[model samples]
Target: MTSAPLAGCILAGGLARRMGGGDKTLLPLSGAPMLARVISRLQPQVGAVVLNANGDAGRFSRFGLPVVADPIEGFAGPLAGVLAGLRWARAHHGEAEGVISVAGDTPFYPADLAARLMEARGPDAGRIVLAKSDGHMHPVFGYWPVSVADSLERFLREGTTRKVLAFVNLHPNTAADFTPEAGAPDPFFNINTPEDLEAAEARARIEA
Candidate 1:
């Protein structure tokens, strides 16, 4: 099946407590900002791409993409970032049916990520499609229907649970399994600490 038209959003609103409480996405991974590498792969997969981040937007001006903050305050997590993306897509590109969200710190996500998610969703536009690997689910990386924006906003305001899995369980969902090439780093490798960044740099050099 062909992929659906999806607007991409890089979720970069995390506190990054494990990485010394700053924007982990801005950290250099192999001589480039992590967000830049993410956009390089994600741009072709979707109609448009936006950065879902909090605080000063000027820091990301170099990327030349729309910067959107979560609609809810106090950094509500990936779900809020997804909502922001959904809203932005609806406002800026009405033709997009949904948003494919990926972690900004995860630069090695597959180039076919959106295509696989859309393929998994098939004809059901309302179904939430996420990525899975090695028997683990990555809820932050998913295709969420723009129609669920209202429901998600309500879910955030009405409940204390900020977990993406808990919110996704409220609706029909599918997981697209991905396996990396032999000897290649895991496609979902994310940089949350100095060690992860170092490992990613080594992998980047090897993969380069």
Candidate 2:
């Protein structure tokens, strides 16, 4: 089946408490900002791309992509970033069928991510799609319907402050599994702490 038309959003608005409260997306990974690498990977796969950030959108203006903030208040987490992205997609790419959300810190995201997730969606099933690696689901890296904004808003309103997986499970969705290949590490590796950054640098060196 043909894949749906998708727009991409890099979730960069997280309160990086674990990374010492700085913009993790702007952190250097292999000499380039992690956000740049992520945009490079996602731009070719989706119709449009935007950065979802809360404070000082000007910090990301150099990328020349539109910056969107959470429509809800107080750093509600990735789900808020997703909601901002959905609204941005609807406003900017009105023809887009769905929005594919990816973490800015994940630079090695699968190149076929959009196609794979779109393929997993079925008629009558909810419009959420998650990625799986090593038997664990990565709900943040997935496709979401633009229509889900209302439901997500309600969830935020009810103070349902849980991780993305909990929200996904409450809806109907499928997980697309991917296994490591040819000594390659998992495509969903995320750099949250300094140790992860070191490992990712080593992995990049090896790949290079």
Candidate 3:
């Protein structure tokens, strides 16, 4: 943890075009809603948690987290969710230094995500921190400084590129590497399509 607390952002705002649309995160994994699994994993790692979704906030009301929508229109992607998280953190979690964003569709992200990223933050770093596994950077799972909220909004409004990496590159950032335990499913495994949901169900059964 830094000098201030950290908040969590569950980015459930995706259009899920591949999963045939709708909220893929709300789909059940095993017996519980997949979003529930994500909240359970992320809640323990932060001072507060909020859900980032586009519509029908009531659908997620059972989870008992504040729902924040992308501040920018046109569903500007995950970066917009990050901005929402940052703004929400600033307003509600004034004591929090930043927000740790994770995909709502990803059920098994590392438990130590917040710690690893905070640990990797050197003295010169008020920078954004991202998660990396198997040499692939998970941009959606990142540590974002609340102070960057304005800058992120500007980046989105510029319309140059809404890509997460494009904005990340504009600031000083680094990635924290995560290695799955032997014989365990990749920690970042997420449910996107029916096939991915099937795999998650199987993984959930084995873990159960």
Better of 2 and 3 by lDDT: 3
Q: Write model 3 residue lDDT over 43-109, tens digit each, in one string.
A: 8889999999987789888999999888998878999999999999999989888899999999988
Compared with the true structure, what per-residue lDDT tens digits does model 1 show for residues 1-208? 1356779899999888999998888898888888889999989898899999998999899999999999998878899999999999999999889998999989989988888888889899999999998889988898999989998999999998989988889999889988666765689988888999999898889889
lDDT of each: 0.89, 0.84, 0.87
- Ranked by lDDT from best down, the candidates are 1, 3, 2
TM-score of 1: 0.95
Clashing pairs in 1: none
Please write out the lDDT profile of model 2 over residues 1-208, one tens digit for every residue.
Answer: 1356778999987777889998988989899888888999899888889889887898997899999998888868889889988888888888777788899989898888887887778663346888888889887898888888788888887854647877777787788777677677789999889999999889888877
TM-score of 3: 0.95
Candidate 3: list runs displaced more than 4 Å: 1-4, 181-183
Off by over 4 Å in 2: 1-3, 122-126
Candidates 1 and 2, the one with greater TM-score:
1
TM-score of each: 0.95, 0.91, 0.95
Best by TM-score: 1
Alpha-carbon RMSD of each model = 1.6, 2.1, 1.6
Ranking under TM-score, best-scoring first?
Answer: 1, 3, 2
lDDT of 1: 0.89
